[model samples]
Target: MRFFKLFFVLLLYGLSLLVLPPVSSSEVVWSISARVGDNVTLPCEAPGVVDFEDVAVKWTRPDLGPDQFVVFYRDGRPDPDNQHPSYQDRVDLVHSQLMGGDLSVVLKNVTINDSGRFECQLIQKMENQKKWSESKPISTIVLKVSDPDPIEARVGDNVTLPCNTSDVVNFEDPTVKWTRPDLGLGQYIYLYRDGRPDPENQHPSYEDRVDLVHSQLMGGDLSVVLKNVTINDSGTFECHLIQTMMFGKRRKRSRSESELLSTIVLKVSDPGSTGNRTETGDEGGHEDRQRHGLTGSVCVVTVLSVGLFLSKKAKLSKSF
Candidate 1:
């Protein structure tokens, strides 16, 4: 009788082990970069996920404060009560591929203050289990932010506006638009899409004069050069990027995200008048200084872009 009792106890213990198994964990980290006012994707992919209908995903910035929810989703919708006020309308799941194990989130209108470390936690409901068991962290994403400063140039001279993507652009065909707030309605200074310029949609003043400096657009520079710039170019210039790509293999849906890459103020110095000058030199000397200023401005832009790229590359290397 004692042997039978011991056998029964062992059977019960084995059944309990099957019901409540030890949870495994992984310390995976990811680093992501984005510019100010850009819409970026923080990846948090998972594996072995059969269904997301009963899964719960939570994203938080623990460095900011305890229980600081960046975004949360469960029960077939976002949890309206726990999200932080600053990220209320700016955070969301990029696509509905949670079932395929993609819990990535898109952050809109990113600012310099948004840079920080984010944590993603995923919990899945088990069949016939009333209690919840936590899975290891899906990922820890570190957001690095950069700024695109304004530029200055002179009229009748060539100017290159610098703009680069924060992350690698994998879309089939991406479009970049350069617009001036001082222009008329429904018109842009430069419009490049699918590796070609849309001349019909460009402003008359910029036709055949503005072109993308970078021919190869795959994760490279998107800067444009404007020839024979005029005094009218002295205004706020905005660079916007749009791209469309397929999301998941099972879902036959496409997703597009547009990001405002940079906004620069071009201060065009008139050929006749030395604007913002103190009358400290002759006309010839003034022209030489103006040329020097333009060169210096371009150098500054180049340095800034190189610095940003180096920083991003360093962080990405460490993450991988």
Candidate 2:
């Protein structure tokens, strides 16, 4: 009888261990960098999760104060009551189905103000009860955002407005658009898609005036060269990179995400004009100094030669 009781207790203990939820022991922190208007994903996962219905995930920025979460997901859906206002409509789970324990969240159109440390926590729902277990942090992500600088060019000069996705490995075959917002809506300065430049929607003013290095597309360089830029070209140029992703159980459905990778302000001015005086004046001043220095050296050499010749003649005459 004593032996049977001991065996029963051991069996119960083993079953309990098998039914208990898994806990993440990792405390690793990840760092990610992005530019303004870029979409970035912060990764988090809970292993051994057989059912997502009983799991709740919360992503919080501690600096935002207590109860202010970047994302609060419960009851198999997002709970927006406690989410921060700034993060509203700008955040979403990478996978709505929570496939393979992936609880990563995507932040879209991020700005510099979004730079901060984010924490992800997992809360386990109690069996046959309305209560939940204490939240356990499983991941930490630090995000940094920055803006691109403006580009300057002179009239009639060929200019390259830079845009690239080379930093992202595996990114391929994305549709690229360069648009000048000041040129009215739906009008683009350049457009490339379907492995070639589609000029059908390009602005008439930019016809035959812009070109992209198609050979470098695979390398992620989407820079466009503007030939003989005019003062009218001076405006904000935005580079949009649109990528299509297929997701779902069968991977049959498709969705597209557009990233505004670069916002460059082009300042085109005539040569030697006041609008470009600062740059042109600096170059002109440098050349003037160089010319003056060369002339001064030549004059010194000529003077010294004349004095030496005169001295030599005087010595010869005296000796004669």
Candidate 3:
């Protein structure tokens, strides 16, 4: 009976090992950030890969849905049929031949909506076997795409909408455009091209009211100063960096391919009303502090009175 019981225990343990899946080695999750319209790469690599053609690599965003891969490469080419629509024509392997086991991919023209967690997986098929092994994760990356914070100003006060591209060195003589999307297309607040301000394409309302700091242009500072801001000037502003591309000895400007460096929200308020609100907030805070002090004083007095009464009662009882 004892022998049979020991055999049963061993059988259960052996079965459990087969039923449970093997634990995979952990990979570090990397965090990366990029501005809108910038090209960013997600790093991934599979070590000990000699023949890249025998293996397949897949980059996917699991949160998007099942099978919604960002880039799927198998059989020596990327299979875009199962890829997500948003990533179509925008993603590709860093190396077409998968050099040095590197499975990284370049994501071009990123937008704010592309911020999410991405995963890189590797699939390998066994020799002389038609079935492929389960996909194993090689890397995990969290991408954050964003713009600068909004700017606030009072009416009649000058405000600077900030935009910079110092990190991007692709363009030497890029055109800077600051425009309000609410003002419609072709109606820009300021346009800088060919080392000078192009006021001919600027809106009539912004005439002589907007200026750029030419001294700081070389540092990639495309900041614009809006003088004497009005309440009606409150809106969303976009800064576009247009790169000049060379085509057979001729330089052509591609406005459509411009990168949106920064988006700033300018809020202009009335100075008189702002001052009144500040005063009101200060008065309210002062009143609250006074009430708190009074309450604390009352609490101290009550505590002292109880202690004094207790002391006197004890002395009277002792004398009796």
Q: In lDDT terms, which candidate is top?
A: 3
Error of 2 at 115 (Å): 0.7
Q: Positional deviation of 71 in candidate 3, in angstroms?
A: 5.2
In terms of lDDT, model 1 sits at 0.78
Write candidate 3's Cα lDDT for 143-189 as tens digits: 99986455788889988887777656454566788888788667898
TM-score of each: 0.45, 0.52, 0.58
* Model 3: pairs clashing at backbone N, Cα or C within 3 Å: none
Worst 10 residues of 2 by lDDT: 165-174
Model 1 lDDT per residue over 169-209, tens place: 75457778899877888889887776788786688888888
Evaluation by lDDT, superior candidate among 1 and 2: 2
Model 2 bad stretches (over 4 Å):
1-24, 149-320
